[model samples]
Structures are given as C-alpha cells and as structure tokens.
Target: MIASTIKTQYEGSSHDSVLYSKPYSKKIDTLNMPKGYQLPKFMQFDGKGNLKQHVTHFIETCNNAGMEEDYLVKKFVRSLKGNAFDWYTNLKPEFINSWDQLEKEFLNCFYSTRRTISMLELTSTKQWKDEPIIDYINRWRSLSLDCKDQLSETSAIDMCVQGMHWGLHYILQGIKPRTFEVLATRSHHIELSIANHGKKEPITDFKKDKVFAPNIDKIGKKPAKEAFTVNTTPIKTSSTPIKIDVIKDSTQIKPSF
Candidate 1:
C-alpha cells in the first residue's frame, strides 16, 4: 500500500523518478544542496561555520539570470575547484562568482574597442575600405592614423581585453541590471587606452583649444597702420584744424529731485 500510494501520488509514470527524484522525505528536502554540488558540506563555511550562501544563491540567481539550470549548477561547482571554473563564471557573472566575471567583462570591453578602432581606421584609409578581412587586419597599423597622442597605448590595449570579458559576462547580466559602474569602469579604461594610444578618429576636433586663433599680424598692426595713414592724408587736405574752447561747468547737482 505504501509503494502503491507513492506510485499513485508522486511517481510520474517513470521508474527513473524513483531513483533520482528530488528528496521526498521532508528531512533531506529541508537542507539545500551544496554548490555545483561542487564542495563538500565543509568548504562553504566561514570561520564561524556560517555556511556560504553561494550555492543556494547561485542556483536561484542563475535561474533568474535565464541560464540553463543544469549549466548553472555545473558551472558553480566548477568554480569551487579551479581556474577553468573561474573562467566560465567570469564569462557568466549572474550565474557564478565575481572574480572571473570581472576578468571576462574587462576582456570583452577591450576586444570590442579594438575592433571598433580597427574598423574606423579602415574606413578612413583609402586602401583598406574595400579590402579583404585579412588585408584589413594585417595592415591595421598602416591604415590606422597615429592615434598614439590622442589615447594611450596601454590603456587602449587593457580596455580591449576588458571588453572581451564584459561581452561574455553580459549574457548573464543582461542589458539592464548590469551596473553603470561596471560599464563605466570598463568604458573609461577603454577610452583611456584609446586616448593614450591616440587612435580614436572621430573625425572632429571640437575640443576647443585645437581650434586656430586669428593671426595677430593680419588683424592688429597692419590694419591700424593703414587706417592711420589714410586718415592722416585726408585730414591734412580737408582744412586747417578747428580749434575749440572748453568751458568748465561750476555747478554740480547734489541729488535728483
């Protein structure tokens, strides 16, 4: 009757359900499974034995992140062990831990910027515009204007690497929840790099100080000399200089009525 009752109530017409089904006993069901089923029950603890909330949090977080549940579980477990796991989590932040997530995000940012800079250079240069992919990549240096002064080389390279990481990480984070701080930190690093490398060719120099000033020679000394000469000649020919007498007013008004 107990077997029949279990079959009638819980078993879903599948024998596999008996062996692998989620905990039926209320006792085991109460405790959350370890991460990725990754760590032993011990590692999740802090010095005080406050079990790390990482495992339960990761599963819920990943499901909310729109990740495949199995994949999320596997990835989380992997993170507990080594770098490969770290890489996956870094590549998928909402599903995993922070360390790898940050690294991947940073790289993604860098790669995208590099591609953008490369594309801009190709369009600007005559030869690379219609060239094959191989040609464009290979001749990037020549095609690209020397942007070194405008942006720093190191910053540009670092940002490119960061961009690569972010691109992957964002799949889990989505377009909205990802903080601007994350985006900005990535973007600023890229901009700094582009600025250091001086490679961003926006085709405009509206930054003010770069604009040319009026020439002093053309505007000031020569024009004044020409005005003076013409006036002097005309004044001499016109008539004798008129003399005027100045009278001093003695009375001063103390206040308006």
Candidate 2:
C-alpha cells in the first residue's frame, strides 16, 4: 500500500508540473506513430488570426493525423509560436487538464481582446484615396468578421460606404445597391469601367490674349497711358467737301473745311 501511494504521488507530481493530466501523459508516452505515418503539417498560431479559427484548424490537422485527446492535450504546445507560445508557457501548471479545457482557455485568453482591437480598427479603417474598389472592400469585409456579432448586411454596406472615398461614395450613392454582395459587385464594376473607359473630364478650349476676365491683381491696376491719341470731336464740316489732313507719324488730326 505504501509503494502504491508513493507511485501515485510521483505520477501526480509529474502531471502537476506540466500541461497534461497524469492519465493523458501516461497514454501519450506509450503511443507510437503509426507505420509509414508522416507527421502532418501543424499550423503555427502567432495570435494574429482569429483565435477560434486557429484552434479549429489545429485540432483538425491533429485529428487527421490520428492524434487522440491525449496526444492533442500533450502536444498542443508544439503548435504555438510567438505570442501564443509565450501565453502557453505562462499558464499555471495543472490548470489545463484536458484538451477541451486547454482549447477553452486559449480562446478565452485571446479572442475577446482580439475582437475589441478589430472593432476599433474597423471603426477607424478608411478606403485610401488611391485604393481600388476590390481591394478596399475585401479588406473592410475581412476586418468585419472579427467584430460581426451585430453587423447586418445593410450595416456592412453602410460601413463600407462610409469608409469609401467621397468620389467613390458619391457614385455609389447614386447606384444605391440593396445588398452587400451587389454593392461589392457594382463597386467593382464601376472600378473596371473607370479603368477600361475613363472618367469624364471637362474639355476646355483656350486662347491667348482672349481672357474676358483678367487676373485679380491685374484687374485692380489701371491701364498705362498710350503715347498716341486720335481726336474726333465732330470736326467742323460744311455739308460740302471737307479735307482732313493727317500725317503718317502725327499723333493728333485737325480737319479744315
């Protein structure tokens, strides 16, 4: 009885020092890779992607490789990298006793914080002045997924439209697509048409020295006086023949009748 108790204490000590339970460690230690079984490529979660997605993908890959709960619980830490690895290392020993508990803790640790950050990003995200319709819409939709609890299709459309450039928004306002998909499609169509054809620019015809309106500064200044001037004050004329004398180089003309 004393020997069995000592063995239990030793096993419990081993389990309490790591992530897996004592039973999980025992099963995982005895398991061998199947003959010709190649290790499946595990996804490295660095905390950038959706936490739930990362966990789901990790489980799927491990399951496909015939890893049962024991292996999953024991080996999940191997898949972590960067911030995720740091998070795993900081977990209290023996706190996570099963695969489900570990997965739950992983989600609880990262998911809410990520969603909050994503929500802020979504609120502040804007379509760049030169960004294409396809690219901007794609990015906006991706950000929405992280914070999409209350986001409806109409609200999604509104958010995208609000983030779009004013010129794009003006055109989109006129089109008034009813659904987000239709909006994306029509926006892309607008983009393609603009690319294939072009925007209408006002064609202005110009001529030099024909300005009806002068420069604002120039308009305030009086014209310079001319050296030569012609005077025609109804020159005295008998209804008969009158001769007006003028020289080629003269400035003023005097008519005599």
Candidate 3:
C-alpha cells in the first residue's frame, strides 16, 4: 500500500527517472552565458608558436568567464579557426586530457627563447625621434614585458630617457626620475610645454633699433644738380662805319654860287 501511494505521487512527471538516469546533453545552452564575452578572433594559435600574446589574452578571458578546466578546453577548441583549428584537430588526443598540459604544449609550439632575447635587444636599443613621447614610452613598455627577466622598471626608465630627442633628453637628465611611471609622466608634460611654447606668437619688437630700421635719411635729401657747359664768348658786334664827308662839302659850295 505504501509503495502504491509513493508511485502514485511521483507518476505525474519524469523527474524521478531523470534523477536516476544520466542523460546525454548534446548541446550546451549558451543563452545564459555572459554577453560580449566571446573570445577575440585574433587570439587563435596555429602550430607556428607565434601566439604568445593571443594565448595570454585567451587565458585571461576564460578566467574572467569563470570557466572550469573541462569547459575551458572545450571553449578553447571551439574558438579555434582556420589553421589553428586544423592543428588542434590533429593533436586532439594529446591535449585532450588536461588544460594545463594543453597550454604548455601550445606555448612550446609557438613561444621561443630567442624571441625574448630579440625583444630585449629591441627595447634596449630603440630610440624616439619625432614620435610622441607617450607613444614611444608605450612601445618600450610593451617590448619590455617580453624581457622582464632581463630588464627592470628603473632600467626601462633610464633607457627611455636616454632614447629621447636631445632637447628633451637634456632637460630630463636634470630631473633624474627614478621610476618608469614618473619618467613617462614628466616627459609627457615636458613635450606638451615645448609644443605650446612653439605655438605662441613670437616677439615682433624684441630689439627695436633705429640702426636696423629702413634708411629714411635719403628720403628727405634733395636731388643733386646736373652739371652742363655754358657758352662764355661775348656776342660779336658789326665793326663797319660809312664815310660821307667830302661829297657833302662840294654840294654846299655849288649851292652858294
């Protein structure tokens, strides 16, 4: 009687059978998954071992999503595309056991000790010319991350200051910043100050001098007189005179007679 009563109470639903049987779940319902939490497309790794940055980013994203190891590995596999997907499929047997092992294998395939050395050399020798101080410093910092064992914050600060343009380098040398953060901040402000000063209107009358002014002395001076020759000889007069004396006396005697 008690068994019949219990059976009657649980007969309305399959909940009892579901509790006893482990049914296969073919699909994962991703509806409840966090939005905008998808793995970045650029974060795929082929067999070439050049995806250190991508791997690092993938791990961080998975961690933030609170994924367990099994689910993490599955999600990671699903995220693979193109060459990366092919590589994963070929080695599925080996990496399927553990997420930790998979990560190590992935790194072994892509990350190289020589790459770290190369990054160290670049960071140590790089220089900033016309690039903005902030951009220059950011690039240095990124390269420094790959060679952290070989470089320190203080060393990075010194290298960055040394790589600056001569004008900025000379000014920053006096300040002697001891940390990278402080050095970056001070360099940024110094750059801004230099830019602002360049933009200001230049002094037009700094050294007003009459000597340098346009020569106005010739402006008021009278023009010089032109020289020419004049004729100095006196005008010649006529020198001839007439003689009428004898004929006039003869005519007067005849008139008297």
How would you encode candidate 2's per-residue C-alpha lDDT over 1-257 as one tens digit per residue?
89878987766556545644333344455667656666788878887777777778888888888776756876787788998887887675456556877787888777534544355678789998788887898888878876746687777787789888775687777666778788887777556644543444222112121223222354566656555544434444566566566545466666676
Task: Please report how far candidate 2 places residue 223 from its true position, in Å.
Answer: 44
Best by lDDT: 2
- Which residue window of length 10 is worst by lDDT in model 1? 225-234
lDDT of 3: 0.59
lDDT of 1 at 56: 53
> How do all the candidates rank in terms of TM-score, highest first?
2, 3, 1
Candidate 2 residue runs with Cα over 4 Å from true position? 1-38, 46-50, 82-96, 105-135, 150-155, 162-185, 188-257
**Candidate with the greatest TM-score versus the true structure:** 2
Q: Clashes in each model (backbone N, CA, C under 3 Å)?
A: 44, 0, 1
lDDT, candidate 3, 174-257, per-residue tens = 777888778787787677766655666221211231122222355566756544333333334476433323232233312110
Query: What is candidate 1's lDDT per residue for 80-134, written digit by digit as tens?
Result: 4343333333342233234344334423433322223454453344323334322
Worst lDDT 10-window in candidate 2: 202-211
Name model 1 segments beyond 4 Å from true: 1-13, 23-28, 32-154, 157-257
TM-score, candidate number 3: 0.45
Position 58, candidate 3: lDDT: 77
Q: Which lDDT values do the candidates have, in the order given?
A: 0.36, 0.69, 0.59
Q: Judged by TM-score relative to the true structure, which candidate is superior, 1 or 2?
A: 2
